[model samples]
Target: MKILIDINHPAHVHYFRHFARIMQSYGHETLFVSRNKEMAQRLLALYNIPYMDRGKGRDSRLGKLMYLIYADYQLFKISAAFNPDLYLNFLHPYPSQVAALLGKPSLVFSDTEHASLHHKLTVPFATKVYTPACYKLDLGQKHVRFNSFMELSYLHPNYFTPNPAILDVLGVQPGEKYAIVRFVSWAAAHDFDHTGMSAANKLKAVQTLAGHAKVFITSEGALPTALEKYRISIPVDKMHDAIYYSSLVFGESATMASEAAVLGTPAIFIDNDGRGYTDEEERKYGLVFNFTESNADQLRAIDKAEAILSDKDAPQKYKHLRETLLADCIDTTQFMVNQALQFSTAHPDPVMPVNS
Candidate 1:
């Protein structure tokens, strides 16, 4: 089988790299085409991921519109040449649409059910739209629902193991307490801007938390200079390591916040709209806590963190929850790959190219 995957973000790279490897192992060929977003270059170097760069334009509205147009054109050209047996991607509008137009099977993996303006136009065209049942968006078909989240495939305990070596690389020493803080711009088509935490709120939370643990901050935009006074450390790109060993995680980024919770690192997520798979599923499964921006309820979260930190039995509790969650969820990557391959074989398009 031949597969073409279009990745739009650094998180997508991490999430899909394992899937690409899995496909290759099954005697399939894979090609990745993606936006040259923030972590793209480094990810390519770190993972040896081969990708075609669809460079970003400026950050203005006009620039974004033009970039999308260019990206579509590039995807069309790439798909024409590669003629992939199957098109598998996260939630790409133009790329997936092009694949469908080519009469090829397009499997769109998404956790968001809330239809973005873009999805309103493109989702109906996809052959399969896989989503977590907690997704609030209505895709108007049974194929749109998937019981599993993308995180389960990779972040689940079955596949994920914390790298102590990565801790060493980050210069983290024993007994040095630290908390991970993540902030995202949420510039996607979703109305996620409501989850924005002000600089004052972050400093206030960090000040309170830092009194108990070292604070490490990571954000899509730059951190406030005032945060530097508190000795907050934001590593250039060692986010996974920070989350893996953190005393706790607090964030507005739905994805990373859930990653922390599922990894059994207790997390507090404050979002205007809690719409991600991890946020909805983790809380539903009682593995994590979520707060709306208006509620801003940190009291219970703070108390929970304090208890978890000082208690001798906290790690054991986390371990138990992690194990329980893992047992209940399906491996998302294996399920997605198997389904994609099956779809490809059953509906091969002669006009489409398969890498091998």
Candidate 2:
């Protein structure tokens, strides 16, 4: 089978790379399509896969609209030529739109709940929509709920062994403790201004956490001068290693927060947003804390830190829970690939998203 995977962000590359590899391992020809954004190219370059860059335009609304329009046209031209058997990627409208046009069975994977705009653009066209059960989207019949997150499948212990080789790559010793902090540019078109931490707040958080442990900051936007003082020793290229070995993670980026949790690190999501997927993941698996941005005061964080450290059993407990949760869940990549195969076999021509 010929397969194509689309990546809109750097993290998406991490989440989907394993799946693409599995497909290739099974003798399927795989292609990766990516937007020229952030470190997306940097990360995807690690894999030996064919890929194309869908260059982005200005960041403004009109600019993004123009980018999407131009990119979608380009995508259509590419899809017509590649003629993939399966089109898999994040819940992006453009790729799905092209897949619909080319009659290729498409699968969209997303954990985002507040997807009103996503639904308006992509749902009607996708062949299947897979999400964590806790996701808030109303897909009616097309929704396929899973108990696990995309993070757990790829980052879980079964599939992920802490490649200490990664530590060598980052030049970090085995036992050094560090905290990873992430900041999102709420300026993105889809960001919705929901990022609870401002540049000033991030500086303060990094400074306070740095008092206890070495800190590494990863942000979608440039860091402030005060925060940039603690430059990450590990190149942005090897961030996952730093993340995997981190003692703790404090971030507003849901994806990284969940990634840390799956790595069995103490992850704190400091955002005003409450009880979202990360929050639920923390409750279901004991590796994380969802601190409301309002209550993420320094004092509160100190207490949470103390609790995580004081409980000698906490990490072990979360690891146990992660293992158990994973045992009950399907191999997400295999599941996705199998779904694509089945869809293509059942419907030679692309059908509208199931239940649409």
Candidate 3:
């Protein structure tokens, strides 16, 4: 079987990198095409995943609209040449539409319920939309629910193991305490009103956490001069390497927060929109704590962070919880590979490609 995958984000690379490898190991061919979403290509190179670059995406609404047309034109030409059996992406708009046009099946994976516009634009064109079982919103008849988080596709122990050498990259000595704090720019369409870790709160958290452990701040936007010294300077692909070694993750980005939890590190997620998987990670596994962006709520989160760091047994406790959590989840990369192969064979496209 031949598969064409569209990677639009750095996380998308992680989600499908292992799946792509498994398919190739089985004697199948794969074509990876990616849009420039900050560090996506660099990470792909770090993982040795070969792919075609679609170009860097735009910032303004009008620029994005223009880029869409250019991207689809390029995709059409690429698909005609590759003549793939199936198209796959993390709910990308272009591949789903192009696959439908080519009379081939496209599989889209999604987890964000709040990306309503994205869903409406892409879901109808997709042959099937697979989502996590904990997905809060119903995406109608085409939505097929699975029992695992996208993070499991890569972060599951089956695919990833922490390298202590990465600690040397971060300049951390043995037994030294550290915390990773992430801040998103709130630039995505769904993040219109959703905000987390206000500037005041960010400085406060930094000040409070600095007293306990080395604090490293990863931000998509500008950092205040007061916090300039704390800015993290590590390779893009090494973000998880740092997260795995951290004692705690306090941030607005749920993805990194969840990434921390799955790695046995406790995460305190502060956002107005609490995610389903994060909620379960907090409620069932007790590995994550969620708080809204409010004076009272975020303060409690700070207190919680301090408490977790102060507790000598928190690492062992979270490690046990991670094991319990892992035992319940499936190997997501294997599942994805099976789904792409199954969909291709079960519903073969009769229309031959122009290149064919």
lDDT tens digits, residues 1-356, model 2?
A: 78778888777887778777766665667788889888788777765555798885456767767877887888887787888877888876888888888887788888876555666688888888998777865687777886667786577654677657766655557765567777777655566656566556666667677666677777666777777766666655556667777777777777888887766677777655543568676767666777765544634754676555455566566667666556655556655655665654533433212210
lDDT (Cα, 0-100) at 14 in candidate 2 = 70
How far does residue 237 in candidate 2 sit from its true spot (Å)?
Answer: 4.9
Higher-ranked by lDDT: 1 or 3: 3
Could you tell me the lDDT of residue 262 within candidate 3? 87
Candidate 1 yields a Cα-based lDDT of: 0.68
Pairs clashing within candidate 3:
none
How well does each candidate superpose onto the true structure, as a TM-score?
0.87, 0.87, 0.93
CA lDDT of each prediction against the hidden true structure: 0.68, 0.70, 0.85
Worst 10 residues of 1 by lDDT: 347-356
Task: Give the candidate number with the greatest TM-score.
Answer: 3
Runs of candidate 1 exceeding 4 Å displacement: 57-62, 191-195, 229-238, 279-282, 295-312, 346-356
Which whole-number lDDT from 0 to 100 does residue 345 have in model 2? Answer: 53
* Candidate scoring better on lDDT of 1 and 2: 2
**Candidate 1 lDDT, 205-233, residue by residue in tens:** 77777777777777677778877554434
- The better-scoring model by TM-score among 1 and 3 is 3
Q: How many residue pairs of model 3 clash at the backbone?
A: 0
